[model samples]
Target: MYDWSALPRGARASLSVAGLVMAASFLGFGALVRSLEVGLLPGLATTVFIWALPGQVVALDMLASGANLLAMALAVTLTAVRLLPMVVLVMSKVRLEGARRWPLYALSHFVAVTIWRIAEDGIDEVDRPQRLPWLTGLGLALMSSMLVMTSIGYHLAQSLPPLLAACLVFLTPSFFFISLFANAKFRMDYIAIAAGALIGPLCHQYYPEFDLLAGGLIGCTIAYLIGRAGRKRSK
Candidate 1:
C-alpha cells in the first residue's frame, strides 16, 4: 500500500467527517428505494458503477417502469457528463507530479461528493506522490460505508419513517450546498450552483430526464456570462 500517513492531520479528519455525513444523508435513502423494489440489483449495480445520485435516480426510476435499457444507459450517461470536467480539473492538479496511474484510474470510479470534499481538503498539504493514497483511503472508506448503510436501509426500510427518510434524501444536496457556501472560491461557481439548483429542479418538472444535465448547461452559460460582465465592470 502507498504511504497514506502523509495526509495532513486536518485533511484526514475532515475527510472522515464528510464521509459520515454523506452516509447519514444518502445511504438510507438508497436502501429505502431498494427495499421498495422499485429498483433492484441492476439499479444498485448502476449506483456502484454510475455513482452519480441524480443519474442513478433517473436510471432506477426509468428502469422500474420498464424503460428500454438503451434509454436508461443514455440518460445516466448524460447526467454523468458533469464528472468529466470535474475529474479533469482535479487530475490536472496532481497529475504533473506523476504517481502510479493505475490507482488513479481505479480511484476515479469511487470519486463522488463525499470523497471529493475530503480529497479537496486533505490533499492540499500533502506532496504530489501521496495525494492519491490519501484519496484512495478516503474513497475506500466512504464506499464501504455506503455499501454497509445501503444494506442496512434495504433490510430496515419498513421500520424507518418515511418523513425522516425524505429528509435523508435531501442530505446530499444540503451538505453539497453547505460545502459550496463555505468553500466557493470563484464567483462563477457560486452563481452557477445557485442558478443550477433553482433552474435544475424547475426544468425537471417539465423535462424530468434532461433537467439536471441540460439545465446545468444553461445555468452554467448564464452564470458565466454574468461573471464575465461582472469582471469587465470591476476592471
Candidate 2:
C-alpha cells in the first residue's frame, strides 16, 4: 500500500533488514513495558507518534523512578529533540518535486533509528525519480511491523526469560548508538556524548527535574567550546 514497486532492488534488500531490526527492537520495548507494568497501548502510542526511543526510554525510566507526569513528559520530549535535525537531514535528501509529498509527510511519523539507517544506505542506490516513494515504502514496512511485533512481545512477556528480555531491548539502543555514532564523523560528537553521559547522572543527583536537558545542554556546550579552542590553537 505504501508503494514498494518504485523501490530499487537494493533499497528493498536494505529496507528488509531495517524492518527486521525495527521489529526486533519493538518486541523488546513491548516486553519491557509489560514487565514494568506500563500499558502496551501507551507504549504503542509513544513508538508510533513519537518514534523516539531515547525519549521513550527516558519516559519509562522516569515513571519507574516515581517522577511527576510533567517531569516525565519533559524528559521524554528533550530526548526527542534529537529527531528534529534528523528530520531535517532526511528531508534534505529528498528532491521533493513530485505529487507524493503527502506520503512523505505521513512517513515522517515513522522516522526512527532503523528507518533512518535503511534510508541512509538505500538513498544513493535508489533512482532519483523514485527516491521519495522508495523511502515511503521502506518507512511503511518498518512501521507496519512494529505494532504486530509489539503485540507478539506483549503476549510473550511473562513467558520470556529475563535474560532474553534484556537482549531484546538491546535492539533499540544498539540501533540508536549506531545512528548517533555515525553522526560523530568529526571529533566534537565524542566530547558531546562523553560529557553528556558523565554529567547526566550527576545532574540527576542535584536537580532531578532538570537532569537530562540541563546536563545535555551544558555538556554539549562545554564540548563545543573545548573543541573550538582546540581547533583555534591548532591553527
Candidate 3:
C-alpha cells in the first residue's frame, strides 16, 4: 500500500543520478559482451538477472576461457556473495514492519552496487512508505536503459577500437570508486577500502581466480576486528 501517484523531488533527483551512472556503466558492459562474443540475449539476461557488473564480467571472462557452465556458475556465485550483506542491510533500513516479505525478496534482486549505494545515500530523503517505490523506479530505469545500451555496445564492439572499448568498460569501476569515496562516513569504511585495495592487487597477482572473494572477506574481517578493538579501547 505505498503511494505511487507522484514521486518526491528527492527521489526523482536520486533516480536521475543513479540512472545516468548505471546506464553509462552498463553501456560498456553491453559492448563487452559483444566483444566477448556472447550473444545479445545472454548479455541482456546477465544484465537483467545478474545485475552485477563485476559478476557479469567474471562470467563473460570465464565463458571466453571455455570454462564449463557449472564452473562459471560457481565462480559467479562466489563473486556475488558480497551482495548478501548489502541486500540485508538495505532491506533492514527500508522495509516496513508487518508488510508481506515476498515483495522484499523480489526487490532484493535489484540490490547491486548502484542501487545499494544510491538507496543508502538517498533513502533518508524518501518517506518510509515511498522508499520501496523509489528504489524500484531507480532500478528499473537503470535496467531498461542498460538493456538498450548493451545492444548498442554489442553492435559497436566490432567497429570500436580495442582501447576505446576497454575504456568504456572502465566506467563502472570509476563510478564505483567515486561513489565509495563520496558515501563513506565511518572509520571502518576507510579501513576496509584501504585493506581491500592493498590486498586485492596482491591477491590478483598471486591467485587471480579467488582474489576477489578472498580479498573482500579478509579486508572486511580486518576492518571489523580493528573497529572492535578501537571500541573496546574507547570504553
Report the CA-based lDDT of candidate 1 relative to the real structure.
0.66
Please, what are the lDDT tens digits per residue for candidate 1 over residues 147-214? Answer: 66666655555566877666655554565568667757679879988898899889988987666566
Q: How do the residues 31-136 of candidate 3 rate in per-residue lDDT, one tens digit apiece?
A: 7787678688888888888988878888877777677777687779977987998898889777888776776887788888777877777788778877776676
Cα error of candidate 2 at position 171, Å: 4.2
The TM-scores of all predictions, comma-separated, are 0.73, 0.81, 0.75
- Superposed by TM-score, candidate 3 places the C-alpha of residue 96 at a distance from the truth, in angstroms, of 1.9
Candidate 1 lDDT for residue 43:
42
Top-TM-score structure, candidate number: 2
lDDT of 2 by residue, 1-235 (tens): 2344675443455446556666677787777777667777877776676766678767776766688988877778777776777677777776556455676677677666666666677677766656667776666555556777777787777677878866766666676667677778656788988888899889989987778888888999999998888888888
User: In every candidate, how many clashes are there?
Assistant: 0, 0, 0
Model 3 accuracy (lDDT, Cα): 0.76
Clashing pairs in model 2, backbone N/Cα/C closer than 3 A:
none
